[model samples]
Target: MMIDNRLCGSWDMISNDNFEGFMTALDIGFAVRKIAVLLHQKKVIEQVGDIYIVKTLSIFRNYIISFKLDQEFEEYTRGMDDRHCKSVVTWQGNKLVCTQEGEKKNRGWAHWIEDDKLYLELYCEGEVCKQVFKRINS
Candidate 1:
């Protein structure tokens, strides 16, 4: 359950691509989609031993996930899709890969550090939303 400690920091969104498409694939309503697309996001990742806390922050809403690596837990996408899913996160090489099992097909996300930038790929229903974040703290 060891992780790359370098990922523990504050990150600001640099670019988000195809986020609307990804939200549409999740069956998100138009109103929320519009608001979500307009807001920039910040991420704060903290780790202690094998436990990880990931916070996705924005003006409109925030989503947080806390769990130990490789441990299965119930995750409710409350402010987002409002779906209940069993989720587990584990490392695939240097990337932190999370697989969510529930109603949707191919639903998951992966975060990896590349060239000092935090890269995130959100997947659901064959749609992939790619987002990159730049470190904001020394």
Candidate 2:
């Protein structure tokens, strides 16, 4: 139940790549996708006991997920994709990897720390969106 301390903090998005392609693969509307691309997303991760709470924040919208490692949960991606998913997260080495199963194929995301920054790779339907975030005041 001990989560990695490196990921337990606030992070601000510094770079986002291939986000449009990723959104397109998810069948998101053009208008929503446009706004989503411009959003400066922030992540706040909190761990208590065996549970983890991850909040993806933005001015346009916000998404939150809470679960324990190695456990599956029904995830409703409310403001993001508006889809229902069976999601499970597990630790692979120092990286936290999540697999989402639903309508999309090859859907999942991973979070890891590298070069003093937080890195995220969101993928669905053969499209991968890579995002980098910097820690806030460490």
Residue 11 error, candidate 1, Å = 0.1
Pairs in clash, predicted candidate 2: none
The digit string of per-residue lDDT tens for model 2 on 1-138 reads: 577889989999999999999999999999999999999999999988788999999999989999999999999999878999999999898889999999999999999999999999999999999999999995
Clashes of each: 0, 0
| CA RMSD of each candidate after superposition | 0.9, 1.0
Model 1 lDDT per residue over 26-114, tens place = 99999999999999999999986668999999989999999898889999998999999999999999999999999998999999999
TM-score of each: 0.97, 0.96
Cα error of candidate 1 at position 29, Å: 0.4
Model 2 is weakest, by summed lDDT over 10 consecutive residues, at 1-10
Best by lDDT: 1
